[model samples]
Target chain A: MVQRLDYLKESPSQTAGPYVHIGTNPNWVEITGVWKDDLGLVLVGPETVGERILVEGRIIDGSGALVRDALVEIWQADAAGLHNSPTETRGTADPAFAGWARQPVSDADGLFRFETIRPGRVPFSGGGLQAPHVTVWIVARGINLGLHTRLYFGDEAEANSVDPLLNRIPDPVRRATLVAPRTERDGMPVFTFDIRLQGDGETVFLDM
Target chain B: MSGAYFQRDRDWHPPALTPGYKTSVLRAPRQALLSMPTTPSEETGPVFGHDVLGPLDNDLIRNFAKDGGEAIGQRIVVYGRVLDENARPVAGALVEFWQANAGGRYRHKKESYLAAIDPNFGGCGRAITDAEGRYAFRTVKPGAYPWPNGVNDWRPAHIHFSVFGHAFAQRLITQMYFEGDPMIWQCPIVKTIPDPAAIERLVAALDRHETIPMDSLAYKFDIVLRGRRSTLFENRMEGN
Candidate 1:
């Protein structure tokens, strides 16, 4: 197979702007502070009792087009269903559990792989419930236009059934894009998700 | 890599850091890293596009559709003010802007405005400095364009302002919103003007006889490139 590449002549790494890393948003600012993993974590669901699972995904823009050189940052609650809020979870003294995190850049295939334990269910406004998921942020072309979305356990059909945000996405296929993949691959339980940006197969984002 | 062959200097040399001072800043040596060339091309050719290859569907903001094409070599003036951190007037500074006309366009290929994508309005203009560091452009104002926000929203009629000498790292990229516009609140990047009259002050004040300072309809866009003082960070170990 031939590798697709930019014919700009010079290497992009040589031409890219300096200080491209302005900083991550507050959510991720809180994340890299604490909940981070050096090794890839297997994304486990309610059905699979995974001693080893690797949750991997590629984030695509609104047009379902791959943002080849994008950066995605994510952070979520641990498996215990607790957040790093002084009003909530402990580890307040420790610098790690900031409940925020960051990812520098996406790979050649526009893929970003995050290693983390399964997050627990969280509450939402108006009795609506947020499923156990990971919040994502995107920085592409050096501008940090914060993109907030979540990743949910697909194998957990019962949990997905009650999720308010997923239920409100309008289109079934569009809603399905938000679900994380859970299946056996190469002798390991692996969750594969391809997060889509705007238009079809996408998640919601705030104005901020 | 070819870059590795270049001579390396490990010595650290820096002047005493000072706040609100230009001497200390200009003296600051350029980084070892290659600096991108930002020189504006002085070539002023037949800038307006000519329908030489005939019109195509892929192109927008076609200026060459008519005879002799759109107005090229049109000279205009730019008038605007300068505001400090608290949005106060910083009387003496330099403000310069380079952009295409009302078509929301640019001479450069990499423009982000949608008006450039439109065939109707051709946006292009540039403003130079004045005594008060005020700047103005001699062109029709640009129209608000729609962006693909989660929900569709139109950007307010605005012009970008670039400022210099305010401080190091004071390179600000800001757009001016037309006065009395409702969309200002909805814009994600627009830091709201606390005062209702802020917009009016930013606009050309007709009664103040400051109306139309230079060339065509004047727009007084005072800018503070930097938000006052900020540190020029240098990484070092504890002892150093």
Candidate 2:
């Protein structure tokens, strides 16, 4: 066995830019039939475990202007708290769930929406349970690198209060940025998660 | 182990002011939250394959003549290699690009119709990298256009490029400018890149040797992704 291992140095990052969507989601631009739909259009099917939910929000910049061209993607575990990954060693995850979704902000209102099931609590490698949450990745014009953050359910206050990662945040006020408040829009349950790219109420962007 | 150091650019990008230039509003804010340690979730990203690829008939110059029509402007070839920080080629990477027409007009609904549209030019192209991490595109030389950054402000002639490496986390998007374009020095968007080296990397050099001789002029721009500079994250110990 080798005593030491070497790794590749990470390359510097750059913004996703003015024409990202045209390249990534051609169908959305009226270029049709690339692959029926994008890869992350569905997070779960009828046979998947968990309550189906809709995640909606907008990407706001530092000046409080909506980022009309921003793209958002989410990844999470199934309702049983197991990831749909080939590397998952704990046990087999739900086969019906893909656990990922991607959407671009709408042109009219700059809002982005995803259809997925609410994720369940997952185990922390150390010793505790993490609150149920979904990881979100955001990219847009003027954004040098894709921003990383988490969206926790507002209704899951009990579990969130003691989440391993949540507890690491030094300020309670900043922690609030991660929670998606529950609301009703057009008679359907929606978790509103507005991402602030900068300024007064900047969303908590993770280092990774 | 060398300590992991991820220094946020103090000058590059938005939120940082560029002297004598406007147009940096709505950029991301600088905060402590962005500097916090990233978990495993942030480090790992999804893998992309043929599924996300565009149609095989995506070459812009060729498509420009699909209707037996011609795209207006100077024909040019832009080519490059996508490499990691280690200078190793990143094979099979996806490279996508979009730009304005020779008249500096985008073929989009939101764009103002002030500039004449080149019906033959779709203004978009994409290609997969070969084993050598090389990709190329054939298109017209885009024209400079006006923007709302400031009164009489104009964007330099540029083509936006997006590259997706093997992993999701390594995706990158940036604009490429023609070498020695005077507008680059004055454009706030180009000026926002803090580092001189980084700013220089955005420019594609004129490749006289690779020019199509009688057909088209060639330009080269090489992109380098982050190398093996993984952060030295400490192992989590219970009850630490």
Candidate 3:
């Protein structure tokens, strides 16, 4: 059969290149990028430790098997919407920004946790900062999966209404799914982002 | 922080969002066969070499490759299936395989195959199958190694397979080869491993159905990620 090359162009198989993800480069080892230190992207004169958010998640197989060696990677902007990467320009003062981190292995329970300062307000391409959000990438069993989502402060209702990313979503419940509740810790703010990689509570992703 | 990414202030209300973001996808619980996340960790440690791979090692190219630095094995074909609770082809699933090229060696930089010193057939390759969800590759069996733990172990000649289903959440990672393959029998990964031959309806059927390729034999590997009835484990918690 004569193959229509155009159809082949549309096949996702053509996308067999190494998945471009936020965390974990090549093997699961090494400390690369600006997210290496405690304050990921919070520019608080080095004093504002930013919000404390714990990203607990699992790596279950299609067979529902938890692969222990699986590595979890997360990249997010600080509460100020500024990424730690040199690229992110924050409303807070700091030109040296780097917005990324890599957590090599999940715990024995297939769980992973990250302690980062709240992201600051940074601008998107056409608009202003995206939701105070983080992007997640789960690499286990040699398979690289990409997941992008944002976390909103629990009571940041005013922000949610005008949040560039959230405002685009028309649904209430699904949009609500994107916002992580804000919890308090030692007079500091915290957001618990428990990621469900697959099945029921699998996180919703951005079009990109 | 700029007010751009604002949550509702006392005077503000949640802005109206588009329907697609929240409505494009709905989630349901995955069956058991495909959901193997709740299993436990079983690592007996370093098993290097001693597993037999049918045709992969016999690569006529092997003769021209490095000496002493080699992994050797037989050319045998094994078969199996990956089905839902009702037993169906998980088609389009992806499988990956990694093993020492015999001689219990890896072609990675850490393993010493650096272009600076040497470059060998110790690299890794992957393959995807047809609608049958079946896959095959040409590779040698694996060997075990002695680590700090101090044990006479050999890495299994197992192939690591990662499958992404129709949905992003339906993905799974697993391995398969043979029952008698030394690694399969003694490797730590086999403890929780189910009986390969008796894996219910989705068992991989040896493809006696086709002519064996001469270059390097072939294997019919299939994996069942999810569905109900026959104890399939779908990570319904993640919303597959």
Candidate 4:
């Protein structure tokens, strides 16, 4: 066996804390002019293609209190099921789509919202195609490490049934936590995914 | 092209339900995490360009200065290379950092610390790694602050770092403690990590060679991200 050099272990994780906004989203905190605007604020341009949609949710802790200090980030493929990353060698993703966004929870309501297009099906490394989904990561003052999870469309029931990731969790009720039911408001499609950090109905977090 | 896949070492990370860190009580998930192979989603990530950064983005000392006065505190320069586990340089990675002011107080309104905040010090800065995976930033040394986690617990002087690796699977958010700081070993958050060596990796060593004469000292803190599995392991898995 060819011996590999002793790899360096990962550094310990710490909480993002209450002041996370100052560093991640300086513009939002009134410390203007970091850039024209904060990065990840706009994932789609006017020319971007696909069905426009909005993903919104509130992060609730085990105590049933809203986590106002939380920061939520999303990464998803473009409408064509392609990523706008250099590692993506399959096909070019939509140049207009940024493919990522970060949003701090609302101070008043602890709600995090993202405006973007519906994503297409992405291929799983093992074999079959995965249902169209958005990868969600969350961090906050009390969160020691960033939590990883997924948001699947409840409307796509057929696709959701056979999703490789969703299938990994045998319990139907636990699996349902990953799917977000869709509703329409003001002529816009909105998917509500409430992430519970602990207790019953807690979201299925992934270890990638 | 699908590259080699490597599983995250679960043992390397601290458990989510540590009681010493009082916040983990209600925040930690009660259930176990579902392990999954890396998909295209995990292999790819967003790309940032140099055009997005302002000229003084890496200089915290003057980036938020008011009235032509710089931040108050001991000046220091932090520099290091972002590398993968295989020792390969990770270029063009975004490194964002924030910290308390010299008096151990944050600029936020909720800060109850008695220490006064320096008006000139915004206490945050960012830098992008070069082609060689090297990134450097200039700022004042942050002060240690006491928190409500315990009766009287003080966090060591540290800077919170958020780094983006080439892949989404490699993204990491951690803190860097100053070398020779006794408070590092006593902090409840630092004690959560099971491995002493891993905790040591979080400490940045003072590098006198890089220090500017009569100006600012330098600290070197190299970061290592998850690496792609070797091709040999891939062939073995396929029973080649």
Candidate 5:
């Protein structure tokens, strides 16, 4: 039996290297020629519509080690419940906000921070509104595939209770993993979201 | 289960699922909860235009090579087309990659490998697919290095790839291993694909025609994004 060699086979999967930062966020790695700044760093300008908020948290691996090299990206709807995307036919998202961000877990403590507005409630496919939440994607050296999750605002308790996706999680404890605790720091609303990759308090990582 | 294709086998990936694999702390079990709907928010966009591109984005080798200072190792050209599962070209996809240096050490602070740092290579690059879905990069061959996975376990020579197609749902991230690397079979990462046919698809062969006479060698690696499989998530609203 002979094998065909016309198109090269796609390579096997490997974890993103420790230096994914250099590629994804070149400016952070000090690769100056790439761009003035990395993409998704400033998702919202001053004119962006939304209740601006500070989202911060650490990514803890199962062994309790901080995934220092982890990179986190988030996507969400603007305050008007509109998405900043070309596919959005319902309404235009705030022109000032891209509604997306890519943040690296800080080397000091594996904490990732994003400065953006609190996302507005968006609709589910069939009907009804989802909770005000941010879709998150996480990648690091040990993670073969990027992990997907969501962070709902703790203050949006009513919306959280009715969120279609949150209701999908069968277990209450697991559902709790999706909510971000809210607080006020420096006179601004802050949402603390800690993502646990594995173990007792493992975050609810969505398969998509 | 006829005609149903699960992307990964539990045994092959996240090695901890296999009894006694030893990296239990990092492994997350494949649960029914993972299967969910992908909403419009999950998508990257209608297209990834030049807005996301960086100045030195396309050429990975020269970005880190520092003014034509040749990085130490074998120089090779990696070129390929980004296509849909149906075999159509996917133009305007953002293709990005990073890898270890010739000595198998990354430019990361946490990397403690004793190998000498290639003052010339930063190991990162990004290129947008052309109208024909073609992309290319010039880089040094990466070396194999031991990891904490197990005793004597060394990663195979490979390049990490991240592609953002027309939409977020079309995004893919995978590694391209060198053809004929003996470590392909031994590495747990490669075995994770489960299907023998799928695993074979990952190895890129050397193209003598692509090789530059007295200058460098070339390798061809084409990446196929989802077409019909993407429909599976259309109603579901989540998960890539």
Candidate 6:
């Protein structure tokens, strides 16, 4: 017998509570000296490659109220369809791009924003190209476990049509919830992607 | 071009819509969760350098102290290892923690608890696991407090932990309860979990062996993250 120990079960998740900012982004809450700056504040520098774009959105609850306490994190590939991770076996991702950012929804506006380059099409594990998309993870006081979802570009209609993951959804109406339509703000490309926790037009939460 | 993938065990997690946890009623998704495979985006995560941590980043006792004052409470040392399901060490993982002070009061403006806040306790800390996947920190034993969830629902003393494994998919945010805390059974939030075994995994046992003599008691809590499938299975698929 190998005599290996049994695998340990995962720990139970709990709510992040209203003070999650104190731990994740202390500086945002005015607690200084924890770090020079909070991690994930900047995703791209001036030298980063690809189309510079901005992503903004709010997390709305089932009651149609904005969740001011929610924290949002995003992960995506670089413009060359490469990830800035050691696990990425493809070509090198943009050295200047971190490709990950965490932002807390502003208490005043209940909105979170990220400035980065448009991601390129990444390969689906099942062997086809996926639409250029950004993976989004959300946590808040009411949420016991973090919710997982993705944001697809509405402008990539041609690519979205054949995306393995997006096409898996049988209903086009539900699929539309994952697409963020592009709009211009002061000559800058902006994608507004709002996430609804429940009820009508609920986002397609992913189980990965 | 792809690596081994591990599926999340949804059954182990509490349902999103547990009514007892009042917040879940409105926040849980009504639609069934959609399933997907791991991608570069899911498998990759942000890398945090050690430069981000300061000298007192992991010592909550004096991290926020002013005028050389220490937090008021029973001092404790929390030690543990971050491991994968396969029992492999998950080194370089960032472990962030926060909790109420010894008086059961958080240092936040939104905290409604009437307990007095300790001037020396900020109640938050961070640590990066070593090559052995072990991490330790010193702090005061947090006090249990009441919440507005129910008429008299009181939460057990607990510390919140945020862990980041090598992959974004391995990120986890959870709480660690003290062993023998009867309130763990009474809390509506802890009740949401269907399995008692899973709940037990969240409880840290007192480690007398590791306790500092007359200095601080010790608690041990080992965290487990999702593991990758064996390479042999990937090889078989490639051959097929």
In every candidate, how many clashes are there?
32, 15, 108, 0, 15, 0
**Over all chains combined, what TM-score does candidate 5 have?**
0.86
Give per-residue CA lDDT, model 5, range B103-147, as digits (tens): 998886668878888888778887888899998888889998888
Q: What is the lDDT of candidate 1?
A: 0.40
RMSD to the hidden true structure, all candidates: 22.6, 4.8, 17.3, 2.2, 5.0, 2.1
Q: In model 5, state the lDDT of residue B193.
A: 61
Which rank order by TM-score, best down to worst?
A: 4, 6, 5, 2, 3, 1
List model 4 lDDT by residue over A1-208, tens digit each.
9997777656667778778888898878777654567779988889998999999999999999999988898999999999989888779999999899999999999999999999999987766789999999998877878899999998999988889999999999889899999999999999999999999898899998
Candidate 6 residue-wise lDDT, B1-240, digit = tens: 446447777778777889998988999998998887677778887777777788998899999888888999999999999998778898889899999999899888788799998988888899999999999999999999998889999889999999988888888888899999999999998888888888899999999999999899999999988777655544232423
Query: In model 2 chain B, where is the ten-residue run with the lowest total lDDT?
Result: B1-10
User: Which numbered prediction scores highest in DockQ against the true structure?
Assistant: 6
Tens digits of per-residue lDDT for model 1 on B125-183?
A: 22333445454444445555554443565555555443333221222233455556776
Off by over 4 Å in 4: A1-4, B1-5, B232-240
Return the TM-score for each candidate structure. 0.37, 0.80, 0.39, 0.96, 0.86, 0.96
Interface RMSD of each: 25.1, 4.3, 19.4, 2.3, 4.9, 1.9
On residues B1-240, what C-alpha lDDT tens digit does candidate 3 reach at each position?
111111111111111121121211121112111111111000000111113122332231242236534324544344444453235565544444444444444433334422131233432433444566565555554444322211554445444444444322233344444434545455432332234332221222345454266634445655554332223432233322
Q: Write the per-residue lDDT of candidate 2 for residues B12-108, one digit (tens) a residue.
A: 4333333334433456546765444333333333434545554533457656345567678898989989987557797877787888889998776
Model 1 ranges with Cα > 4 A deviation: A1-19, A22-53, A62-64, A87-99, A142-144, A185-188, A206-208, B1-240
Residue A45 shift from truth in candidate 2, angstroms = 4.0
Docking verdict class for candidate 5: acceptable
Clashing pairs in 4: none
